[model samples]
Target: MEINQFLDATYLKTASQANLTEEETQQKVIELVKEAILYDYKLVMIRAIHIPLVKKILNEAKSNVLIGTVIGFHEGTYTTEEKLKEAKAAIVLGADELDFVVNYTAFKKGDLDLVRNEIIKGIKLCLDNNKVVKWILEVAALTNEEIIVISRLIKQIVFEDFGEENAKNVFVKSSTGFFKTKNNLPNGATLEVMKIISENAKPLKIKAAGGVRDYETALKMITLGVDRIGTSSSEEIIKREKNRNKGY
Candidate 1:
């Protein structure tokens, strides 16, 4: 498969971390959008606040690269109502896809009803609005068994409640890329965890985010059936692919 087709070139940094003021942050997003257009990436993932700017830039350049944003990002602690509001506002701002951080903490605490309800609401809203939806499971923060259980749960919910075709538009994504981990272990997609997710989330689509920094690893994810890859290293990965193809 063509590697760039699976890449969601990302830049989700906050203003402070990126060392940019508000205007500068928008400029950075503009640059990212330009790069995504140049590379023919599948999408450009940015924060929700920048969706309008991204839409404007892509429109002016007449680029079709999709604009994606995260809701309850980096933390899946928002209430169902709150997440729905965020989703609606994002859709209004012209976001093509919505990646939501699932309420995994509640699930771990035996609050499966709450988790289920939230995910159901979130997915329905996105589907009804004709927007792609992805649930960020934050695998780095869960146990192996938790990963399987949650992945299965997401698939079960989407397929059973919304039918298989709608489930195809819903993705079980691997990470938010900001979850703090003990010992600084990789905080994003890992092959083993992805294998577990792919095995369980069949027909629901899978997106491997975080920690996917190089061309080799990205290709491995495609081999493992990842439909989308989220990374800040899209340019580097594409550059590496070009060099390798040229036998350099």
Candidate 2:
């Protein structure tokens, strides 16, 4: 398979997170968009604020690389209403997909209603606007059992309420690439975590985000049932693929 088709070229770091000035961060985003246009990757995953900029550039270049953004971001602590508001604004700004961080903390606390309600509302907003939606589970923060349950929860809600036909646009994404785990453990998609999510969230697509730095790991994640890969290293991965094809 063509790796670029399965890649979501991502750059979601904030200025503080990368220790760069706001202008520098914006320049990086501009460069990312140019790369996406040049490579023709499936989508450019970025911050909502960058959506308008990306849209402008992609349009100017007449490129079809999609625009994806996050809601409730690295932390799923925001209220459902707040997330919805953010999502609505993103759609208005021309985002093609919305990756929402599921409130897994509430799910772990056994507040099923809070978690379920947010998924329902957030997904409905995306579907209504004809935009793709992904639910980020932040796998490192949850136990294996929690991962299975949450993935199943998203699947059940989508299939039962939103109808199966819409499943193509709904993805159960793994990670925000920002969670700080103890001992510097992998804070992204792992094979074990992805297996649990894949077996349970089927029908709904899977996006493996975070820690996917090289071509080999990205291929393995796709082989293990990841429908899309969210990574900041798209250029390197593509370069490695080219080198391997030439027997480098």
Candidate 3:
């Protein structure tokens, strides 16, 4: 597949407090949106909290990408019910899809069924409310085996709820940015998780977030079948990629 095709889809992922004001955050998001359009990039995983100010950003796109948001983001402690509510609210505000954090600790504690059920519930809620879902496994917090299990179960659970064809919209993603962890596992975890997801979650979309910085890395993940990227490093990556293409 072409690297540009993967660039067609990505997330601005403004998970920060420094740019919190509605005006300031909207300015940042709009600038990213326009940057994507200018570079021929197409879908964006925008933030839910900033949805109210998304209109101008969405309108500014000449080759506008689709808008997405995160659920149980930054933390996976929220109940599946909370994720469902947030997803509904996001859908009402025009979210094309949602990136949900899976309760990995709960799964590690042997509540595997509960984790799967919760994800299925969230996806059901989104579909019932007319939206799509991207389930984040947060690989930084999971073992490689657990990652495989979660990726496998996500595909199974989504199909069980929404049927095979509709399951196409259900994605598995890495939200490894919760906190800086020891041993540097979370740092390059997206690549490893993408390998497992690409191998196990056949035909399912995979999103890579946290720790992505340059074009080569982005291109590598996309080649491994990552459908979208979540990054705060868009400016640096785009410019560097452009310069590389120009042989600079």
Candidate 4:
């Protein structure tokens, strides 16, 4: 089904996280950009620091692959101002999409105002900059009910405040692929969780990130109506897709 078009080729690890030198990390990003160019994947999702490098390479290659970066990554504890500031810098650095980790901690603490405020401001900033925006809910840390509520909350905020036309530019993403869960439980998008999100957060798009590693799982996500699949295994998935097409 030409799955590369639905993939957001992702590499969001830092040097320390991967135990690599800074140069090695840059090389990884370079290879990722090259792979995206080769496959014509929808976008290459990377850390904000690498936006300029990615932008330069894509521009030189004349590749239309979009650049996406995270804001308030991993943890959603950052204040709204901080998230907005990070997003502004990403925009300035040539990011076409901004995925902000939503402040679920505040929502868990019964601080609905904090959650609402950030979503409003964050979505506004990205829309104003003509950038696609996605709110990462970090489903691993949340209960099913929380996922339903937060998804609905985001949908409501975008539809009511931003109007129907702008809702298309927003996405309700499943995870940052960085949340630590108890007992090494699945830390990314699970189909069950995705179903809840998809039903609750419509009008806005859905991006199922983390734990989506192979062609079978990725195709399932697409069949389940996810608009984008974010993963670091784009090449492997593409290989599997080729095998399936070849009846191997």
Candidate 5:
């Protein structure tokens, strides 16, 4: 397998959480971008604010690693207009892909229309700009039934509103890595969650994020038909692959 192509090296730490000043945070983003380029990862997923800096770094390095950013980030409660504006700005700054945190809270409240509207607007904006879009469902926050419902809803809406071909460019991503669970359980991609998502979201791709930190788990996700694996441990995973290749 072309493991590098399957990995989206990610670093989404903000200024405060990372305990860095704005300049320090920018430096960290640059380091992440450089690592992605050096390793030839499929993409570098960062916070939206660092898109331009990443774009500049990749351009200077003569790298083709795609640049991706998150919208509405860990929280999916942003107004649709706000999400749209963030998407537009990220694209203007050279983001090749946008991963949006879907309003699952509204969906859980039986407000499917609101959730649907936000997704439609976000997807349309990305498609119109010839960019890739992924909707993050934050599966840790949902029940099994909710996962099936929302996964099916996203696929159905994408296919019905845009043609099947356009729908192919969209992804049903699994997590945002920041969901606070009552049980304090893992809030990212798991085998069971990947199975549910893959089984429900067909034709449209799947991006497994959160908790996919090692080589073996990442390979398992790909085996389950995941199209992308988001991880901050891309280098470590790749190193493990190398060790295995050497008969270790």
Candidate 6:
């Protein structure tokens, strides 16, 4: 299959959720997701607890795409146990993929084992749900060398935790919409993870988020081995795609 065919959209509908009521947010999500599918874009749900409700919407729309939820999102403060609970709960409610935030505090402590174990727990929880797990490394928090180390640690976790299934499910990501170091995302970090993704995450997927504002940046990532693009800018991106099509 063409990798382009495998490219998909992950919608971070946080502002929509905060700005609108649950029902309103969900209605808009359904409309956007249906539109994405019409454009042959695979849908990856981010944030918003209304995802399960949209699962039926996808089915009705005849869209065969993934429904994802963020686990311990935005910040990596959630403990290993909390992450496991969140993952299981999300899966029980129809989440097909779990994008788990890595335990940054543990990583900061140099507690590599704790980091790996937490990741393993998340992987197992997703597996139990008969689903896939994507580990968002939040690479903007890590230095260049740190990205490589984290990538290697992820490789080891995949090798030890759940074998090929987990590896296939795993994704290395640039940011989770918020950054501890930078107020906004850095393209250098985005390209840093792309470099790691190209060199390390061969079978694994790469999702680039944080400051992806236009079609050019998004397309550059897709061409560079990124499998998924997470953005709240989906509407703008699609409009750009359409304008490019119209050549106006």
Q: List the residue pairs that clash in candidate 4.
A: none
Better of 4 and 5 by TM-score: 4
Q: Each model's TM-score, in the order given? A: 0.98, 0.98, 0.86, 0.99, 0.98, 0.84
Q: Residue by residue across 121-162, what tens digits does model 6's lDDT show?
A: 777777766786777777767767777788777777787767
Taking all chains together, the TM-score of candidate 1 against the true structure is 0.98
Residue 101 alpha-carbon offset, candidate 4, angstroms: 0.3
In TM-score terms, candidate 5 sits at 0.98
Error of 1 at 98 (Å): 0.3
Q: Kindly list the per-residue Cα lDDT of model 3 for residues 1-248, writing each as its tens digit.
A: 33444552344445365547666767777676677666655466667766655545666543455677778876676887887788788888888778888887798898977787788788878777777677777787778898888888888776666788875777788774655579765553367678998888867777787788778888888778788777766666677777888889
Error of 5 at 182 (Å): 2.5
lDDT for each residue of candidate 4 in 1-248, tens digit (9 for 90 to 100): 99999999999999999999999999999999999999999999999999999999999999999999999998989999999999999999999999999998998888999999999999999998899999999999899999999999999998889998987899999999988888989999999999999999986899999999999999999998899999999999999999999999
Off by over 4 Å in 3: 1-5, 8-16, 19-23, 60-63
Deviation in angstroms for 79 in model 6?
1.3
Regions of model 1 farther than 4 Å from truth: none
lDDT string, candidate 5, 1-248, tens digits? 66999999998989998888999988888888888998899999998888877888888889989999999988899999999999999999889999999998899899999999998899999999999999999999899899999999999988899989886799999999888877779898999999999999988999999999999999999999999999999999999998898899
| Comparison by TM-score, 1 against 3, better one | 1
- For model 5, which pairs clash? none
Best by lDDT: 4
lDDT winner between candidates 5 and 6: 5
lDDT of 3: 0.72
Local accuracy of candidate 2 as per-residue lDDT tens digits, 108-133: 89999999999999999999999999
- Candidate 1 residue-wise lDDT, 1-248, digit = tens: 46888999999999997788988987888889999999899999999988888888888888879999999887899988889999899999999999999998998898999999988998899989999999999998899899999999999999888999886799999999988999989898999999999999988999999999999999999899999999999999999999998898
lDDT of candidates 1 onward, in order = 0.92, 0.93, 0.72, 0.95, 0.92, 0.71
